[model samples]
Target: MKQFDVERPGRAEREDRPITTTTPTHRLLPHPRDLVRFGPHDGAHRPAARVAVSVLVPLVVLATIGHVEWAPYAVFGAFASAFGRGLPRFQRLEMQLEAGLVLVACVVLGTVLAASSAPVWLLVVTIGLVAGLTSAVSDLRRWSPPGPLFFVFGLGVSAFVPATASTVAVAGVVAPASLGLALLASVAGALLPAGRRALATAEGRRWRRGPRPVDGRRTVVHAAVCLVASIAAGLLSLALSVESPYWAMVSAVVPVVGSATAGQLVRAGHRLLGTLVGVALAALLLAWHPGVAALILAFGVLQFATELLIVRNYGLALVFITPMALGMRALGGAPVDVGALVAARTADTAIGVGVVVVVLLATHRLRRPRPEAAA
Candidate 1:
C-alpha cells in the first residue's frame, strides 16, 4: 500500500540520472560490510506476505490432492505476484497481469519441451532466446526485478524436468489457476483500512505519472547481452557436465541486470556469496528430509524471507533463494542427490559468475575511451 519499489533501492529518485562508468579497480571490490548490510524495511512485509501466501496456497492444495509434483508449475505462476510490488493499485494490477501472462507462457512452453524430451542443446538455445526476449520486455515494462531471471528459471527448469502429455495439460490448468490466485492476492490488500487510506492518498494517484520513455537502443543492447551471456554460460556448464546447466545460465543473467559495470560487479558478487552460503544451508535442509507438510511450510517461510531481504540486499536474499530452489526441485519429484546437487550448484554458479565477470571486464575495457579521445 505504501507504493514501495523493492527492485532497486531508491529507484524513483535515481531514474533520471545517467549511468556513468566507473574505473574497474574502484568498482571491483565492494566494501565487505556492504554485502551484509540490511536496508530499510520499506514495507517489505506486505509484498513478502503476498508472495508467500500466493505460492503456499497452491502448493498446499496440490499436496492435498496428491499431485504435489505439479507444484513447480504452480510456484512459477505465483511468481507473477512477486512483481509490481509497491505500485499504485491499478498500476500494480496491470503489471502483475502482464507478468502473470509471461510466467504462464513460460511454464506452458517449458512443459511442452519437457513432454517432447527436448535435447539439452535445444533447451539451452530456447532458454537463451527466452532470456533475451524477456529481458527486453522486462526493461520495456520497467519491471522491478528487471531482466529475465524468473522467466529463464521457469522455462529452463520446466524444460529440464521430464514430463508427459498429461503433465503438460496439468501445467496448463494448474499454472493459470495459480496465476489467477496470485493476481487476486496482489490486490486483496485493498480491502484493508490501511490499504484503503493509501489508495485515497496522493501516493495512489502516482500511477498518473505515466510510463517512462522507451529507449529502444538500450533495451536491444541489454537483450543481446543477456542472450549471449546465457548461451555462453549454458554451453560452458554443459561442457563441464554440470548436473544443472540451467543454474549457470540463470547466474549469467543476474549481473546483466545492474545499470552499470560497477553495479554489475556488485550483483555478481552478491549472487556468488549468497549462493555459497545458501548451498550449505540447503545441504542441511535436504539432509533433514522433512515430511511433506514440513517441507511445504519451509517453502513458505523461505519465500517470505527471500522477498523480505531481496530488495534490501541481493546477496542476503540468495541465502534463502538457493534452498528454496533446491526444495522446489525436490517437491517436483526430481531425484535428489544431495551431494551431487550441492556440488553442481556451487560449480555451475561459479562458472556462470566467472563468465559474466570476464565478459563485463572485457566489454568495459573496450568501451573505455582512449586518452587521445579524452584529449
Candidate 2:
C-alpha cells in the first residue's frame, strides 16, 4: 500500500526537471467525471438522478442479498466492472466498513436482544448508537471504512456472546441476509463514485497533469491514537451509564479510533451528528407508524437521499445513516423504545466525538510537527 511522504524530494527532483521514469504505480489513472470536482447538482441532471439510481440499485442488489444463490452477485459484478471501466484501482473504501459494522452490530445485538425471543430491541438500540458513534469517531484517524477489521469486530463479538434466542431459523436467515446486504452496499459504495468522481462530474472538470502532489502520511500515528481513544471512550462511558446506557457507551466509541485520524474524522463527526438527529426522528416515526413497511420506505428513501447529499457534503450522509442504522437494527425485532433510544444515541455520539478530539489533541502535542509557511 502506498502512502504520502512529507520529507523533501530528491535533490535533482526539486530542481523542476521532469522525472521521465514514471512507473505503473506512479501513473495517473483517468479520473471519472466527478473525481475532479464537487457538487453533483452541477451535472446536467439534478441530484434526483442519484436518488433514482439508489432506489433501483438497492432493490436489485438486495433482491440478490435476499436471493437463494450467487447468480445475482455475478451479474451485478459484471455490470459494475463495465460501469467503472476506467476508474482508479484503489478508490478509498468507506461504506464497506460502515455497512459491515451495521450488519455485525445488528447480528450481535440480535443475539443479545433476541436470544430467547425477538425482543433484544434494547441491545439493538444500544449497538446502533454506540457502533455508529464509533464508526464516526474512527474517521478522525483518517482511516476509511470497509477494512476487514469491521468484519472481525462485528462477527467476533456476537460469536463469543451467550447464544439463546438467536435460533437456527433466525440465525440462518439473518446472518446470510445481513452478509449479502453488506456486500451489496460495498459494491454500491465503490461503484457509485461518490467522492472524487461525484465531484468531477458535478464540475465537468478535467485534468491537465502537472506535479504529483503528496497526501497525508500521519496515518500510522493517527490510527494508534484512535484505537487507544476508542477503548478509553468505551470504558469511560460504560462506567457512567446506569441501565441501557451502559451498553450504549461501551459499544459506541470504537469507530472513532478505528478511522485513525484522516479525513474520516470529519465524516465520522458528520455521521454521528446525523445519527443523533435520525434516532430522534425515528422515535417520532415509530410512535406514528411502528410497522415494518413504514421503516422499509423510510430507510430506503433516506439511504438514496443520503447518497445524493453525501455526494455533495458529508453532513447530509449522516442524516440518513442515523435512521437507516436504527432501522436495520429492527432485524432483532421491535420494542416500545422510541424516546430513550434517540436520547441515548445523541449522548453516545457526543462521547465518541469527544474521545476522538481529545486523542487527536494529545497526540498533536506529543509529536509536534514543524509549522509550514503559508502560500
Best by lDDT, which number? 1
Using all chains and alpha carbons, the TM-scores for the candidates as numbered come to 0.89, 0.50
What would you estimate as the lDDT of candidate 2?
A: 0.40
Q: Give the winner by TM-score.
A: 1
Please report, in order, the local distance difference test score of every candidate based on alpha carbons: 0.81, 0.40
> Residue by residue across 1-375, what tens digits does model 1's lDDT show?
233322332443232211222324224444555556665676788889999999999999999999898888999999998877656766777888888899999999999999998889889999999999999998888876678989999998889878999989999999999999998998787778766776676656455436567667567766887898899999999998988789999999887864456667777888999999999999999888877788899999999999988777888889998998987767755568899889999999998899888877766544333567457
Give the runs in model 1 whose Cα sits over 4 Å from its true position: 1-33, 202-209, 332-335, 365-375
What is the RMSD of candidate 1? 3.8
